[model samples]
Target chain A: MFRLEVRSSTPTWFNFALPLLAIGATLILCSGLIALAGAGVLEAYGVMFTASLGDSYAITETMVRATPMIFTGLAVAVAFRAKFWNIGAEGQLLAGAVASCFVGAIPMPGPLAMVLMAVAGAAAGAAVALVPATLRVKFKVDDVVSSLLLNSVIYYALMALIEGPWKDSFSGYPISPPIEDSANFPVLLEGTRLHLGVVAALIAAPLIWFLIVRTTLGFRIRVTGENPEAARYGGIHVERVLISTALLSGALAGLAGVSEVGGVHFQVMSDISPGYGYSGIVVAMLARLNPLGVVPAAIFLAAVMTGAEAMSRATGVPAFLSDVIQGTALLAMLVALLFTAYRIRRVGVAR
Target chain B: MSAVFEQIFQVGFLAAIIRIATPLAFATLGEMFSERAGVLNLGIEGIMLLSAMTGFTAASLSGSLWLGVLAAVLTGMLMGALHALFTVVLGLSQHVCGIGVTLFSSGLAYFLYRLIFGQQSVPPNIKGFQTLPIPILSDIPVLGPAVFNQFALVYMAILAIPVAAFVLYRTPWGLSVRMVGENPRAADSAGVSVIATRFQAVILGGALMGLAGAFLSMAQFNAFTFGVVSGRGWVAIALVVFGRWDPWRSAGAALLFAFVDALQLRMQASGLGHIPYEAFLMLPFIFTIVAMAVMSRNAVAPSALLKPFRREER
Candidate 1:
């Protein structure tokens, strides 16, 4: 008889295989959804893969989309590693966008203006994050609820600003005035949408990895996360580490917001992000909170998202089908991770 | 100032506040029960959204608002049960699992709603819940109408506070539930089934959340829209934290949130309103976060809250 046995620690192979298994499972489940939608499953898959990465422009689009995911994913991964749940990435992103818009709207010189806008955006995002970080450290407020609620509040605040004070005077649209051309992120490729933001995010990934692996602060954060009591005994100042990580995470998430506005949209709008902050959570989880792994994980999500539109156009499948696939991937990954952590074993004969 | 007082004293404004607070109150209490049982039901927003769609569709089809409410409640329960299964049985992280449930349900609900209703140029409208005024209380000039004149669900929501408080702090089952939340190992050794208690609490909370969603679809508005819930679930979660796990306090926080919501709506409707509509829209969320920050310091959560329980080796 086939039997299952418990393992104290998951094997290395299982660790590497989990994400692949999750992707496979998600594809199988999504294929059923495609069939239900009256589309041929193979054709749907074909459209998705081809449209996401088949050509140069598609690849560029994927990178553009993946840029923000990389920053936000790293933001989340860093905080999660520190055992600090900063669910307010969305709010932070919005704050960053608002700040960037403010900086960009000012008539400053080109390079200095762009750098200042990025700095201002990062500052604003970090400032918004300070409330929850302080509350979690000082008052023990659950960061999850505060961060989530703050997101809506920030979104509404952005809407208020754009619709009220910052409304485009000439166009009468509910969007901010476009930033000066000099303040905008320079496009990296002549014919592609990819911008300097992609470079910023790519650089941030390895920098974060280096910080976690080499720095004293990173050591404190890891120690605090592993054992708060022991870390406290060791004089690590757990709360300080948490607060710093939360702020850093917020800053990174803010950079994502900056990239969206300065890099892509060139102006701040109310719906600046299509839940990139939330999507970052999935990317972080899929990467197992590894800073280095975030790059590949983000690219995968970006591909799936980019492909969904193509699949929809070609096969009459709803682009929203991608959301189902994404959600299923998250769920499958969680289950796979849990099984890897601990397996149930029969103590004796089967009942 | 007197004129402002007079306006605040008006029955219509009071009624509006109570009406607005009704769904929030029910959901807050439901969240209270779930959190108190050591499970944070972050899926509350998604549950409300799904229920709103289901309840609205059912009522529209059956031509009975009550039946629609039932359908909404049942759907909420199922979602709640799913959450409980994942968090309580499968031992998944409450935060992630809750998020998954919300995303899954929200997307699924939207998909299904569009599939069934088709994207009509105008949204479907249905008959809404009618008010049932308390005979004696309705006679009072302003207070009576504001407090007593409401839909049946509103009355049920108001009644839930004391009932919830009594059940949570008074009864044997309540003690077991609290035990499970406080110290699951001890509770398990003392013959309390931790899994069963948590499951029950979550289901009960889900049923209430369903009723809350039904109220949004069946009473407050005569139709269901994609944004019906509108971050109310997050508001409820914040209220639970602000209230510090007490049923009455949670209800009070919900009432406070309702007042802000009503005030914002009123300001938007008033021609002399100074605040931007979006600012008003964001006020409740801002207030909730502030309140959470203030109350978080001394807040005493359940000892076992958010930690999945496993029986210790004998």
Candidate 2:
């Protein structure tokens, strides 16, 4: 019988390779599931890959799909670094989308209005986050529960707006009226859905990395996240750090919402996010909370989502296959990551 | 004033509240157990959705509600075990692992549901459990039908509250669980297996969560959709805080939410188009946050909650 013992240190190469191993394991497990779903496993994989990244058109759409994810991923990565646990990014994103809808509907100079949309979206996101952050800091309320609960409230509020005040009477649907043309993100690619939001997402990674790596605020946040008690003793205002982190996290998530509306959807509705906020958590974890790593992680997840649709269309499998794969990847990566810090070695016989 | 009283005092409305609260009661009790044993299973939403799907599908195929219930319970247990694998065995972060479980369960449920039942113009339904009315109690005025008459699972759920309380407070096993949650190192020194106790607590809690899902599919709605569970699981987390981890209080909290929910449904049915229905929908969730904020200060969670136990270190 093999008994497991923990090692103090693991090989550095294995640290980087673990994510690949987790992905490979997830793919293998999902292939079995696909086979059970009655599709040829290799063929399904083929469709998923080709549809997401094979051609320039496909790759462009994948980037479009990745844009919001990049924003939300960075948003979550920021919060998790400080151990803030802002699960309400979903709610924050919705709030931003609502604010953007209002600002985008305004008749103003195109560039000015677009800038205002981003600003308003960020402000609203931060405002929505304020409730949970304040409660967590002042009252010691469980941020996770509070943040999670807010998602439902924010969701219904959006529903009320779309179904009541913002309803597009001309469209015969519950969606909001289309935003003014001035608010639309300038197209980046000739015929594809690619827009300036991709550029925004690209700019976000380096900016966030700079903030985390080069700034005084970043140093304080890192100190607070690692050991609040020690930080307090070190004269760092831990609560202030927490509150600031929460606000910034919400702002990033809010940007994801603005981009979705201005760049991708153009009109606000309830289903504006296909779990981008939740997927952000996955992306953050996959990148190990490194702001710069969120870029590739977001794109990888976006490709999986894009490919799931194509795989479903081609092989008659459900599009939800991506959810399973994503979820499995998250769990597998977590388990695999353990080996990076502590390797399991065989010990004495099992008790 | 008379009309307002009449609107609030209907026996049928009260019965709806009872029916709605039953599943929440089950989930709250389940979560309470896990929290007491020092784990936060955020996978409640995903577990409910997956179990609901499994329960609905099994019932539709074999035409046996009991088997469907069993299947759902089994699924919940598996999820609980999966959570334990991450949080207990591997000593990973509870929050991430719980969320991961939820994602996996929701995804798998959706995929399986789609594969087993192709896209239909209208979703298929199941033959749900019939309501059971107790002998003389169900015949009495307003209180009779509301309290004494319900689906079989509702009775079990209500009964489980007292039983759970008894098991937790009176049994030696319960003592060990509480001890482990409060101080795992101490529990280990006292000869209790922290790993085993945590596993039991999580698995038991998960079974109840599964039962809650089964109740929703096999009794409450008779149909499983993506939105069937919604955020009821999250609401259960709130109830745990509102109840302060006490079984009886938790049941009361669950009923309170259900009353608000049922009232909203009734208000919508009354054709009061003047009022925004979304406001009514938002009421329960808003009430949860307010209640939690007000109650959380006094609420005492298990000291070891969210902290993975390592005997060798401390």
Candidate 3:
């Protein structure tokens, strides 16, 4: 029999190795589904790899897909660090998209339009996040349930907008009117769809990392999450830190929406997010809630997402395999995290 | 009565409200039970979806509704155990594990359904349960037919409230569940097996959630669309909080949500073409959040909810 013994300190190697282990385990586990679907596991994975990372075009596409997730990953990482549990990132993302789209639609100068869009989107996201934070602080309402429930409300609100007021007149489709042509994000590469928001996402990660690791507020956030009582004892206003964390988190998630509107789809729609907000949770987990780690984690998920579609086209496995992988990776990462805290040791008796 | 109000309280509207509430009642009760035992099964959304798929597949393939329901309940119980394996035995974070379970289960549901049915223009459908109207009670025009003339599962859900309340408050097992949820250490000291009781409660909760799934696929929708259980499980989560985890109040909360839903459906069907139906769809969720704020003054979650018990830690 083996027993778990607590480690004095987790080795730094575990931080990187654990995510890889989780990904490896996730693939090996999901391979059974491929086999069950009557497809060759290697062949499906091969297609996914080549299609998502095969060429410059594919890499660029993956990066395009990864941009929003990077933002969301930062959002969740910051919030979780402060123990705020802002599960309404999906709603926040939608609110940001709507706000950004509202700004993007107005006839204005291109660069100025983008700036205002980001500001409105971030403010909208922050406002949505503050609800659960305030509720948790003032009313003692459970943040988890409130945050989760708000996703539905925000979703319906988006649906109402597109299907009613924002209805596309020409197509007769239940989608919002497209944003202004000038407001479209500047394409970074000549041919590829990669946009300026992608570059911004790349830069935003390190900036967030600095805020979380090097700033005074970051120390307060870390302390509050680790031990609220101690943080209060140490003169940190715990509630204030939580509210601030919510603002930062919501702003980052809102930026995910901004990128989607400006970079990918330049209009608010029913499926603007494709569950990217939830995927952020997976990315944050894989990153071990470290803002700096979010970039690679987001890229990995983006690759899976881009690859899964190609895998489905080539291999006949459902495209949902990527969704399963995301879920499995999260669970696997959680299980792997246990090893950081405890080591298995042989015991003489089972007990 | 105004034109909208006139449509909202029609006999058919009453029946629609009951039909809508049935799944929610079951789901709310299921989540309530699990939370009462100190386990927050955030996997309710995915659990309901997976169960709906399995139950629908079983009924369609076997041509037996009861068999399909049984399969769904069993699937739910298995998933519940899986959740317990992580949260209770392994002592993982309940919130994360629940999210993981939901993602995993929902993904599996979609994968399996597509594989088995082979994506076609129209999804496969099964001839679902018929209204098992009571001979005498269903004869009553206004209330009787709406309440009594329902699917067998609907009747089960209606009865579940009192039965659940009885089991939670009357039975010794109920005492154990409450004890474990409130103070695991005290319960352990009192010779109650906290882990086992929690496991049992979660499993039982899963069974009820399975019934909710079964009702959706086998009775309400009669087809297993991907969106069949969309956000209903989340609604159930809110209902549990709003219901204050009491059986009667939870069931009432389900009914209230159903009334709002039924009203929306009626308004949609009433040629109110200009109104966005989604606005009405948003009502119950908004209502739940506000209700939680109002109820938080008095309502308290399980004391030990989200806390893992390691007997040796203390």
Candidate 3 or 1, higher lDDT: 3
Better candidate by DockQ, 2 or 3: 2
Candidate 2 wrongly placed segments (more than 4 Å): A1-15, A345-351, B271-273
What is the two-chain DockQ of model 2?
0.88
Ranking by DockQ: 2, 3, 1
lDDT of 1 by residue, A93-195 (tens): 9899889988998898988988998899889888988888887887788888888888888998899888898899978999999998889899999989899
DockQ of every candidate structure: 0.66, 0.88, 0.77
> Which portions of model 1 miss their true places by more than 4 Å?
A1-8, A344-351, B1-5, B134-136, B271-273
User: B269 in model 3: Cα distance from truth in Å?
Assistant: 2.5
Please give each candidate's TM-score: 0.94, 0.97, 0.97
lDDT agreement with native, every candidate: 0.86, 0.90, 0.92
Clashing pairs in 1: none
- The alpha-carbon deviation from the true structure for residue B69 of candidate 2, after best TM-score superposition, in angstroms, is 0.8
Model 2: per-residue lDDT, tens digit, A1-351? 454566777676664587778889999999988999889999998999999999999999999999888988888888888888888889999999989978999999989989999999999999888888888888788898899999999999999989987899999699999899878999998999999989999999999989988998888878888899999999999999999998899999999999999998888988999899999998888887888878888888999999999999999989999999889989998998887657456566657
Per-residue lDDT of B197 in model 2: 95
The CAPRI classification for model 2 reads as: high
Model 3, position A93: C-alpha lDDT score: 96
TM-scores (chain A) of the candidates: 0.94, 0.95, 0.97
